[model samples]
Target: MTTINDIAKLANVSRSTVSRHLNKNGYVSQEAQERIDKVIQETSYLPSQSAKSLRTKKTGVIGVILPKISTETASRVVDGINQMLQENDYQMLLTQTSLDKDKEIAFIKLLQSRNVDGVILLGTNTDEALVNEIQKADVPVVVLGQNMPSTTSISYPDYNATVEMITYMLENGYRDISFIGVPEDDPAVGILRKKAYIDTLKKYNLPILEERMAFGDFSIESGYDAMQTIMMHSSQPNAVFVVTDNMAVGAMQYLKENHYSIPKDIGMATTGVSRLSKYIEPVLTTIDFQNEDAGIAITRLLMEKLNGYNKTKKLTHTYRRLSGNSL
Candidate 1:
């Protein structure tokens, strides 16, 4: 491997001159620039980013901590983050927690130890331990999903969006709409969304049936089981509101397997529109949270904080309802 010192010697220039030419931070003569460029092109020399980070205190890298990497939502968000980061001459060091809260906290410290310029957490819960880690992190930490205590965060319109979807179902003559959701640890999707279902039903003076609700772990299998459980109950709902994309797909699968036709036998609506939603049978009426746009916005917030903006930012990303034949 050709080092900067070798490039300097080959170009017959001082190491400081080579450094200036590489960083463009200081003045180097035009003639010297040409010589350095020629030698760099000939040798294919790559500068050590670690050395540059030491001088500037920036790794030119951001740490992205995700809950799960195998989902459509995570892919879209990563695409958006990578797009904006590349534009700003930075890249991400990615890590997945697989929904493990402790891993989220551990990765923050590990990324900090590596001196990442900032961290973007796709949070599942706002646990106190996680909040404390963010608060004490040496680099700025910006959360993308859940609102954490005293930290910059961008949250989804979980409650409002769910209410709108349920209301739309109600307007379409879905009187006995059931709910499939996750645990309350995720205050956004689990708690607020479930609350929205109950409130919307109550607003129309409809009963919130105990057997009409089922909880999933945000998985397609869990969604299938939830749908099965609700369907097997004494009373069956004409419509069901699901929170996440994976669970929604599972519910749709169960309904189809059991010979239930969407919107005729049972209707469905959900959050986080999947990429394949349009092609799926009956399509999927879901909330388009614009995950990629949210990802870009989340990254920009961390970049702003890195650029010395200090105020804690609390933002709710915009959402729009995507009408599908399922509802």
Candidate 2:
């Protein structure tokens, strides 16, 4: 129940001085700052953002959700999102889910109470619970990964991109191809990517063997484990298509440790044209989803929906092949 006026009175400063200090707009003398700081600590006073939002009926803040910011792909997406938000004079608040679908739902429900203008999810999964939350949210929510059947989503060309990458590997004479993927529960990188791999092989009249496929948890360690699992099979593959760059790196590490050289021993490729690719030996053949552009496009969609563009849209973002020695 403490208010700015109470803080001003207790700190022996005018309301304007308190406002200046709280907003960090105008300068407050060091002496005045000390007084305000002391009063704020003593009272545990916080700014009433709800009041400002009530006055203007808007918050110049957009909430962004990501799976992992540490990854280069996510970082590029954020760079694009920040660029667009700054151009539009809006601020951004970001949080990561670390690929936890439950946390995605939790944040969607939590964002509703936090007064965000809108939300943009760098999504990884499309659970029904998540779809329901997105549907019921007061503010417009745009997803930028999985093409949620009922939501305004900008999806990567997962199926097409995977098919292209696999075809490229085949064109290079890699008939015995293996796949490293995530769990099928995630429709985008997990199911669609794997489906593309199998379908492409079938189109080429290649056998889809169970021993040549393995799944990962989107971690480098899991990638290594999956690679190990595939290599251990008696009928080993000459090439592997990994669903993510982080997993690709893990697979690469396993290859090196096990004295299996890349491309020479087993060629490899993956989606997510990440920075890690540049430093890795023989680089990597990856499907470039142009994530920064994807971010910009998705943010523009959110801005449009915020301004009253009605019918929900599902868009497939573009991608291309990046050649490297790995393939």
Candidate 3:
């Protein structure tokens, strides 16, 4: 309930003097500064965010738009962003679009209306209209985990990385591989991984069997269902490369319940290896994408843009692989 006026009256100074001292924008006599500090400590008066933003045009807030941040990978990305923003004294406003294009656009517009200093978008596919809108607003928008033209972006080498892994598997004498993946129609999640699977098969002169490729919803349940269907086939794959660790775990559970030995009976590998992977029977042989680094880098770029220091058209992020037991 204490206002600047109350502090000014108690200190016998103008409200402007108190405001300057609080913002560190101007100096005050030692006695006046001491009195103001004492009054502030006693009253615990905090400035209104709206009023401060109105005066400085810097809200000290950043917006993060993610697609299904509940997942382990997405959560790690959020943690990285939070750590960086906390260090920089900026708060985060998070929204999940569930990978819906319309919802994502709406969220971006809403954040813009709120005058957020910057925005970091996760798992976004390029859209020219969206890029144009972001550019016209003169707001710094950093796209994370996907490449986009005409905007700053940080992306992992997902397609090529998968291709490399699959190539390695084939060269090492693994055949009859089943790829459990999300639907390719979903550009942000499935297209890249599916493409890698198909391309690698073609490069190695392997028969691309329609029955061998199964689509899932990137969930453990979906993975279980897909694996069940694959098992029903007359010929089973010798190895399975699941696109996500969650799905891989589900597949492994199904295999275990059905008494299908792991690695001994069939080989398995997945994209991410979280804590659960180690405890799981065969310990997933997966690639560590370093999602936390991606998150930190994106936040840093957003902060730079917020501070008016970044003037680049685009930025890209890369990834590394971590080998484990299942492969």
| Most TM-score-accurate candidate | 1
Answer with 1 or 3, whichever has the higher lDDT: 1
TM-score of 2: 0.83
**Per-residue C-alpha lDDT of model 2 across residues 53-131, encoded as one tens digit per residue:** 6655878789999998788888999998998999876789898998888899888777767778999998888878889
lDDT tens per residue, model 1, 292-327? 999999999988998899899999999999998898
Please list all clashing residue pairs in model 2, or write none if there are none: none
Q: Of 1 and 2, which scores higher on TM-score?
A: 1
TM-scores, each model vs. reference: 0.91, 0.83, 0.86
lDDT values for all models: 0.91, 0.90, 0.82
- Clash count for candidate 2 is 0
Which window of ten consecutive residues has the lowest lDDT sum in model 2? 47-56
Candidate 3 Cα outliers beyond 4 Å, as residue runs: 1-45, 186-188
Order of quality (TM-score): 1, 3, 2
Comparison by TM-score, 1 against 3, better one: 1
Best by lDDT: 1
